[model samples]
Target: MKDRLLERLPGTRTATDEVRGAAAPVGLVPRVSGFYQEWITEMKKVTWPGRKDTLSSTAVVIVVVLIIVAFLGLVDFALGRITQSILSF
Candidate 1:
């Protein structure tokens, strides 16, 4: 898998040479750590929504879901009544 990955990277490693000699991990650990730090810094810069915004969004979602559930329940009840009436007839 390592050999295949190294082969895929352009201008990095070729297939002929010994895999250990071919694969030289230079500054990989520091680069990954820097990436994490940069990601955290970017996240801190984001304009996060306030508590009011969060509450309103949550309320809207709950109301919409409740309306849909009520609608489905009414449809199910009507269908059940019609089915029972037809079966009885």
Candidate 2:
């Protein structure tokens, strides 16, 4: 099944063939065009998140960050006060 799929793909040489040193015609123009064609095809298949989904995810991240910062700030303040009181003696 993998062999059949690779045969259908545009590239002239399969991995085995390339490993066995079966030289395919190396050309700059054809390689660039083939790369771009495959890239565009892949880009079309991507499932991008919707605007609402993106906004909700961003808001969740921001809220989590703010909660973490507040907790850290409180811990720092408590530690600082304890250290100052110990040094005052």
Candidate 3:
């Protein structure tokens, strides 16, 4: 038993040293400084819309939303009238 424990001492010391070396923390200053550079690089890759394309896309969205709102309003008005007629009878 004594020889077995003695033999394991070197392995345990090597494992502990490796863990201590590998577990060291990283610094934050370099990451913070590179953020603006990273952001500008990403923005350059985007395909931004022109004035005519932007206006047409915006108009389409507004028209579709208004049509949906009008349809819902008509449905609600019809349902209310039907309910009122049934109750008045």
Candidate 4:
């Protein structure tokens, strides 16, 4: 399985060596370009979320944040009232 996976990888050591032997030594520009090309290739394989999934995830985050904020605000208010009563007495 790992051998098959390695074979699927872009520019594995043996492939890189063959290409390097045929061409000029890889310079910084080629290296950077190769990195970006590989990155784009890998990105293409990614399973990105659909628009509906993204929207639902965002909505869930917003709802949770609002709930936490409300709870904190209520706690602060209660603490403030208790402090005031204690100080007055």
The candidate that achieves the highest lDDT relative to the unseen native structure: 2
Cα-based lDDT for every prediction: 0.87, 0.90, 0.84, 0.89
Per-residue CA lDDT of candidate 1, range 1-89, in tens?
98778788878756454555744446989779878998999999999999999999999999999999999999999999999999998
Off by over 4 Å in 4: 1-31
Better of 2 and 3 by lDDT: 2
Candidate 4 Cα lDDT to native = 0.89
Model 1: residue 44 alpha-carbon error in angstroms: 2.9
**Model 3 worst lDDT run, 10 consecutive residues:** 22-31
**Top-down lDDT ranking:** 2, 4, 1, 3
Query: What is the model-wide C-alpha lDDT for candidate 2?
Result: 0.90
User: How many pairs collide in each candidate, listed in order?
Assistant: 0, 0, 0, 0
Predicted candidate 2 versus true structure: per-residue lDDT over 20-72, tens digit per residue? 98564489987898789989999999999999999999999999999999999
Q: Candidate 2, which segments miss by more than 4 Å at Cα?
A: 1-18, 21-41
For each candidate in turn, give its C-alpha RMSD to the true structure in angstroms.
8.1, 8.6, 10.0, 8.9
RMSD of 3: 10.0
Q: lDDT per residue, candidate 3, 1-89, as tens digits? A: 97658658755554446667744235677666677678999999999999999999999999999999999999999999999999999
Q: Estimate the TM-score for candidate 1.
A: 0.52
Could you estimate the TM-score for every candidate?
Answer: 0.52, 0.56, 0.57, 0.56
